[model samples]
Target: MAKRKGTVFGVPVVVALFFLGMMMPTSVGISLGGLRLSVYRVVLLVMFLPMLITLFSGRCGKPHLFDALALGHAALALVSLIHWGGLQQGLESGGIYIVEFAGAYLLGRLYIRSSEDFRALARAYVVTVVGMLAFTIPEALTSVHILHDGIAAVTGGAPAPYIDQRMGLERTFGPFDHPILYGVFSASAFSLAYFVLAEKRLTNGRGMALVLGVALATFLSASGGPYVVLMMQAFVAGWERVMGRLPTRWKLLWALFAVIYACIDLFSNRTPFHVFVTYFTFSTVSAYNRILLFEFGTAEVARHPWLGVGLGDWVRPVWMSDSMDNFWLLIAMRYGLPAWALLVGLMLGLVWAVGRRKGLPEPWKRARHAWAFTLFGITVAAATVHLWNALFVLFLFLIGSGAWLYDARLPKRIGQPPRLGPPAPRLRPPPERLF
Candidate 1:
């Protein structure tokens, strides 16, 4: 609440630090007892107790379905890991994963208490993305990652090397571990900035500029996953603006999508998903790899449906790489179906609950719109690419941040507005006398 240098634009100091820590290179960390302590992890550790206190104190309102699902997903992940690896290794890996997932979610749930708080978060996200442009622009031009190099040099860890080139330019990963991750992080801010920080209109120059800044950062990643997220959010936002007056626009859009999907399935040899992958990627090889990932990954899930293979290597062709690009498939293959179900349920349920709420203030409505748009984009993008580490945690955090809206109170009407002309005569003022 204090106006201090550490807390900028009403964002709490802890949240500000968390944003900073997230942008730190992955190599900037220390190892303890075989567990890594990265900067953001340390911040989470510092805030974990406070998050627990606030969560249990009833200040954040009753725990929602998504909250329980988040915890259950993490717990199941831990149990699944322990089932595969021995308890010792499992505890190490799974404990860290739990801390990353639930910790981030609870922190968001605790700190963001109102629509104004969410606007502060939007400001933080926009500022973070715009500031990173200083480094991203250089990285995009020179094909060098100064943050990775500088952090690695200080920490004596190996710097992340340049990944494959696209469009004759090196992918600009910025401070994230991968180009896709960086893109996702940057792309996540588009709707938040446009809808929360600026007026939602083409004429709102500042809002348009903020969203454009986020898009630029997303584009620098040069990865299909980020492109999908940015473009999806843009499409949804545009639809909301253009078709806003049509009450059943969303239903109409879904109907159209279903028709197209049915036609694709009926007429084409390839499934709709396969067609999507083949056409929506930066390269055919990438699309082909994702197709194989989907096929083999789902097979593995079917083979071990209850508790999945955990950390063990999944069975795939010798030529096929071990890495999976599909987030949903990877979850089912790694943890199990239940874990995937809980997570998916949480996401969709949150979206449904928030969208169903009535009488929220106009600002709260916009906040809900922004949050939903961002989540929908990320959710769709995850099918084409996997999320891990910071991006994964950030997704859960954003979800938690929006959960406040479900319980948000409608704005109280103080009184009717004053009449501009002379007050209405006898009818209003002489009721008792007339009676």
Candidate 2:
């Protein structure tokens, strides 16, 4: 809690470095499309320097399940790269991929070892949401994206990459590649704000105001992606209230309702997947492209079931299909189905770990709800939008940190430390959990 330069080696400093790197701005920038290697990446590399030192000095511990999954995903990407892009190109691209995404997870796993440490990151996210508003609010009202202008000024790129007019208004993209992605980023930050600023946790009135401000900023982003994510968060909140606390008959009634809905979708020839396609059709171009990409990309993944195509290879199949906006399909098309499976397995595992109804304490239960919402938001947004570099890495970082928290709060026998490096005991008694 001490805000001083001398405390840079502690957990709080991790938050400092992350936000500094994220907000480093493109005024001193470089833009190679999504792979822009600019000051932000440079600062992340610097922030990562200490972790690299610790890791190489034999100070790190055994790999957690999520860590292993990340390593597997990285290795698979490398193999896919070598097959599709050649060994040299693979090394270059795959090296960057691993360093940015996998390295983020590694830092979280080794350094952010507890809920307190994770809160440091959450606090930084809440602050970044406010900082983003300084730019985004202007963009929304006056239709000027300052960060976009700065990127153009420094890198000689387009004035604003993904700006578009829809329904008589200009979509304000802020610092992200697209308007929806900006909304998704805001939505993610809003989830972090909920954890960092619970109702009674902050005495000042700013906590409530900040939460509302994030919600407004998210709404003003004028994109459906974040709206869907917000709905998911609301669903999680409502579910938390009645999920395990409900009587068996009430739970059965909800289950029957779900079954009836599924049956309706099936019999009416509107499958669940079709429901997503219909519900996510907020923008014609993005929705059409997503459907086209999903249809073509799935076939491509089937074609090359193991090591999939190079990043640019699938573009020749359909005109303007250069970007697979959905992250899961992107992975399946480029790396292979295995990578997708591994990534999804890790996320689902986190959801299950947190949703366990056993003697979950108040704090851990809240962590579970927040983390589940994080996973749900990420999953929903990834299906409609794409993020780049530091932003994308931040997604992977949360996945790792959530997994770590789930492991840290697992119930243990009296006098034993919380579970670590082992699977949850199948037959242990309901035990206490940490807040």
Choose the strongest candidate by lDDT.
Answer: 1
User: Candidate 2 lDDT, tens digit per residue, 1-435?
Assistant: 655352343445554565456554444455564455666465555566676566446455544565667778888888888888788888878877777777676666666656556566566566667767787777777778777676666756567655566555567676655676567677776666665556324454777566676787677677777777777775655564556576564357458768977887878776565557667767566666677777887888889978788564774454664776777788888888888787787778766655555776555555555666776877876777665655677677777666655556444555867667889659978788876
What are the clash counts of all predictions, listed in order?
Answer: 0, 0
How much lDDT does each candidate structure score? 0.86, 0.67
Total backbone collisions, model 2:
0
TM-scores for candidates 1 onward, in order: 0.92, 0.80
How does candidate 2 fare on TM-score? 0.80
Q: In model 1, which runs have C-alpha deviations exceeding 4 angstroms? A: 1-6, 414-435
Best-performing candidate as measured by TM-score: 1
